[model samples]
Target: MFLIFPVLSYGNNITLDEMLNMIDIKNFDKKIYDLEIEKNLSKEKFYNLDSYNGVKGEADIKYDYDKDKYDTNGKLTYGDFYVNISKNKISNDIDNGDSEIICGINKNLKNIIYSKSDSELKKLDYLKMKDKFYYLDKLESKKIDLINLYEEYKNNEFETKLKSNNLSKLKTEEKILKKSYELGAIPKIDLQTLQVSRENLEIELKILDKNLKKIKDRFLYEFNIDISNKTLADIQVKQIDISKYIPNIGERYLQSLDLDRKITIENINYLSYSNKVPDISLGIERKKETHNNTNSENRIFLKVSKDLFYYDVNLENEKINLAQQNINYRKENEKNISNQLKIQENYNNFYRNYIINKNKANLESNKYEIMKKKYTLGNITYVEVMDVFEDYLKFEVEAEKAKNLFNGYIYEIMVRGEKNHE
Candidate 1:
């Protein structure tokens, strides 16, 4: 039951976390998703600016040598506001200059409302990306769990091979015992006992071989690794408090749903205000002239304009209805996540029991070693020793399976809608 084999090392051996990181780095789809998120972030920033309606400014300087006059003027405008400043100078008999400045403000109700809605939509898009990134993280974590399962399967496979070799040796010994009995070198009962032992070993070996094949097929299908000649390092198992680590799936679902609702609402707003409102602008101007006598003039200006044919009341109402439908859909999705969380909680309990079983199996294996020492001292018959050996092997196999199950559950809990990895 406690067979020893030479240790093998390979440079390809990697931890579960390291394997996940490698997969992420090499994944083309993940890279594409990240690039899309970056593009959305840039759009969000563009919309978040205060002057999304496009702003411009201009300055002009003029010189007239024949008239011996100079003029400087500057104007700044954004959305519905404009400011103007002007200075004029005369250089003849009188070196005189005049300056004036004016500022005004107004609004384009349609563009302002549209820009606000657009910014909100961009913000919602950014929030949705949070869930997308989280989903990719969970996928990577699941891959790690699968790789760890493969490693455990390989460990069981190695043990099965050892058992098969031992069984073969026992069968050879049984054949020799039969020959000795025929030659009158050993008793018939001794040969019979050896035959019985060989039969039991054959049955156990067959079961082990079947189990090994099942694991091998699964490993190859999932990871495409033949593992026949591969040596996997032992995976470490640790005890953890499951309740403390269970993911809050309901919370995560709600957050994603909130983003969806916000996006829908923003779309409704954009539909309701698109080209329906009027564009207005206010301006102020002042001019000063210094020719024979200084003179200044101030003016206040206002403009209001509206699109003649861009109204869609029915479309706006339809969009609002669609937003309501989206909210309802999100609520239903959240309910589904709640149910999934319950299922995951049950799985956690099952894995906890697996860990307990693993500990019990380990204890049984240690006891079997003591029994083996007693048998070496000739206190027990060979058949009795083999029976204890069979029991110990059974427990060892159970322990290996339990360890893999527990590790898988730990990874599932750590990555399922979790904000932080453990």
Candidate 2:
């Protein structure tokens, strides 16, 4: 922690507890988790190439920087030399071929970073780490919602069963109609209406069954785990304290931070190895005194020259600026994600209270069942009972939906928010 504090502002030093505090996750799916592992493999491969780029040698042709000093004519001369230099930084000279060659070679080595993505392959496996984490977060949220829905459903199932008993009332009403017809107190037309109404209740119960089945299938599909993929033993349901398992937000943040640090180290390798040079260049020069010297006198001089700063400081600065900018961009993105998490927290709290309260309020309802019995006994009319049945089913679904939402909010706080905190 002390070592890393110097490199970053605010000393983004963290521990497991801090990480746990920042993350909110309720579930983990197999497929998304697998994809995240794959993404890490790819990133690790990307960073591995840094070693090659960091050690590449550059071929440099040394000519007199002050060209006027070398007055070599069209004679055969061993006056020019070339040596490979491993220049590690950017070059100032726009016309410098050696620097260009170095850049080209480095680019060639790191070509995989920008290479064409096989659309089909990428589509099949183009999972980014961030995207995988986000996908998992969304699924967790949705799962929580469905689970809550299931909770309300299970909680209020008694009421729904009670509502379905309206079928008995309809049967009783049909009997009354039949008796009235036999007594000549009403026409047979009323019997037809009563029978049809009885059948409609049967149809509605079937529809409810179908809907519950769909909801179950949806849960299994999203989690990428079969809800039917349970143990053979009839396991007793155990209560879980959701807060105990809310996850360390700070830990997730640090894991992501570690990945980022590795990436940064890899990226910096190309810059680090830009200024390497081989041995030295030795050349011979002829200095001719022009005081009647072209006619008779020639002085031979041995000259040795080496590139003092193989990498151009100005060019290197530009590259450094670009690299720094990229680093800054990623940091900014992380900041945006953190801010969004802050906004989401309040929303979760708000929805939790409202929805959970709605769930509890509807849990002990027997109004539907009681009304159904009264209607069958000729104590209540059809119109009077309709709202009672409807409210029972509506609130059952509403409660479940709310519980899941509350679960999702908690997940976001622990999982999604950790990405930034780490």
Candidate 3:
């Protein structure tokens, strides 16, 4: 390790234990937690919209009025039943329909869509994420095992079937050159080609080792724990319950799949009441003039207001119908997803096969190992050696892929809920 202040002395500010302890395990799940918090925060902001706009303030102000002339009797207006506050200051605060109550619902939906768990294609991603964590967890458990593996690689011999293949090629080239020299079948220039081929193969193995070390380092860095390296073994292949998520397809309007279905139903109710009725208003007014002006006129007034959804019945019925259509649309999609889930559920048999493949690959690699040993001892032909080595690499990659597929199914179970779960 390189020290930043090797030449300078600095006092310790925090103990190593304290510094390490500061890194919280909670940080691992911070992504989902933070999104939920943000969603709620946006809801709080949406709820504050009414207060933020100052409570829909209303007031009536008047300049001049004598107590006796105005309402000394305190009688109600002539053509109105409601009290008239002429020459009196009146103010009221009320909701003016700017509450953004709807905004809160939309915002919640937006946040859910943004979060990882709520992704439409969440199944595969969920499994992949688990794999990352699982891989890390396994490595964490097997620190000692990993160290042993590394040590084994460092001291024990590196063997591959390729070497036997190269040796056979070398012998064959030598045999061909000897015959050519005797019969003048070809010039000495051809000998350089065979030598160069072997030289290239040697360089290729060195390059492959370098690449393998780079891959190992990436896995190690993620899996490493600061304490001790104890390599864990016997990892059980995990299975995903693809049935659960697809079963979730049955309820698009269900709370588990959609967090806001309840509020949406409420909103639909509220909006449904909007065109129910209109408010009416009554007013009274009186005017007086001195002898110099002329006679005074007093008047009583009544006013009524109403909003009829005549034109909108045609245009806006679509909106309510739209909600219904969406519910049905989502329901249909849920059915499709459910059907797909069943198909995947049947493939649960494949998950077993996936596990089988995982084990089979290991077996193939083991066979390659045995054949490699035999070839190295010159008991097998070079072609057989190359085939084994190539098969081993392919099997290793295939096993990892199969493990991931099983994980995908298991993730489905977590996302899907119980009866009436939607």
Candidate 4:
């Protein structure tokens, strides 16, 4: 997203947009979020493997001897006369042994199906995280908070200067009133009222000074910069065509939510079906045996396994129902969010207030100028001019506050994914 700000000298000054740009570079939370996204992407790649096990080998051996085998092993009774050469030697053999070895490899087909489905769900999760990284409205919310703090600091600082000037003027006026009272030209009560007003201004100035210090310290702690040394550039309000302005409904974020819910439902459905698909494995085995004669065999086999007691149909149905409910909740949540944003209405309201206050400040400013002229020509007392000045100052401060609100609103909208359509 792009934000267009005024061309002000930024040598020692920082604008709100500049601070926003710094978030990606300076914010620790954003860095952690980035690392988490990287880790998730790595996990997504790991689930693409085709097999989860390796080849296996097995061997068996047996050795035994029988008393009858040792005594009468090698000759048939009818043909003994022709084949009787080895009977004594065969009977003398004491031990018989057999050995077999088999080599095989196998994989569970059901597991493969389940893993593929799971991988898809993980992929969707990764995508959703990526969307959050880009369309981060939460960052905008943080910016709004910072803007308020900064504006408060500036307003307090302005008030301190105004109060100090007024106090100095009031001190001179008190000296004149004191001289007049001593000469019996003015009442003692008038001199006492001026002293009381001057004291009150002093107290108010002290409070303003304290507030300014606290706000400055808070800014330093939170943003890691001493606001005292750095200048704050004024927020420039753009002339926007309200009709053309569009508030970002965060479509990408909402779509990601919908997709996430769909994937959950799909996963539940997949699990239910996979439970019925029995664990099936296929393998080819090679066997070799040795005894008095050697033999070899090769076979292809299929193995099927089922969870005899672990599968629960009712639990699967409940899981599917819960997933559907979550989807429904998400839809309702989106509608509520739409109603709450009120971007256009908020913008218009702030802008209108700003204009009204600005006009009032201007009007009071003209009146104050006329009062100053009247005081110079001796048509008005210095006290009367000060009153007009104080009134104008109040309006001026209000106008500044209104401007802060207007600028803050625009800034929030910018971060909330609206572009300046001036």
Best by lDDT: 4
Model 1 Cα lDDT, one tens digit per residue, 1-422: 01221222225564454444444433444556777778767766666665735778899999999988889999888755677788788776365577766666655555654666465656556465564856565565547656666656655665676567767877877777677778986557656766776687677768867877787565454443444555555555546655555545445555555566666666665655655656665556565555557677877767788768776776677677676768676677767667667756667666777777778777777876776577557575555656676676677676666666666656556555456421
- What are the TM-scores, per candidate, against the unseen true structure? 0.55, 0.42, 0.41, 0.72
RMSD of 1: 11.1
The segments of candidate 2 whose C-alpha lies over 4 angstroms from its true place after superposition are 1-200, 211-258, 269-273, 276-380, 404-422
* Tens digits of per-residue lDDT for model 4, 196-237: 778888988889988987887776556554566677777777
Better of 2 and 3 by lDDT: 2
Candidate 1 Cα errors over 4 Å, as ranges:
1-13, 38-109, 120-124, 127-131, 134-138, 141-152, 158-162, 168-176, 179-231, 279-348, 352-395, 420-422
Best-performing candidate as measured by TM-score: 4
- Which prediction has more favorable lDDT, 3 or 4? 4
The 10-residue segment with the lowest total lDDT in model 4: 79-88
Enumerate residue pairs that collide in model 4. Answer: none
What count of clashes does model 1 give?
Answer: 0
Supply candidate 4's per-residue lDDT for 73. Answer: 26
lDDT of each: 0.63, 0.46, 0.43, 0.64
Q: Which pairs in model 1 have colliding backbones? A: none
Question: Per-residue lDDT for 413 in model 1?
Answer: 60
> Could you tell me the TM-score of candidate 3?
0.41
Q: Per-residue lDDT tens digits of candidate 3, residues 56-154?
A: 223343333442121111223221122322232212323221110000001122222233222222333333334334433332334333333332332
Ranking by TM-score: 4, 1, 2, 3
Which of candidates 1 and 2 reaches a greater lDDT? 1
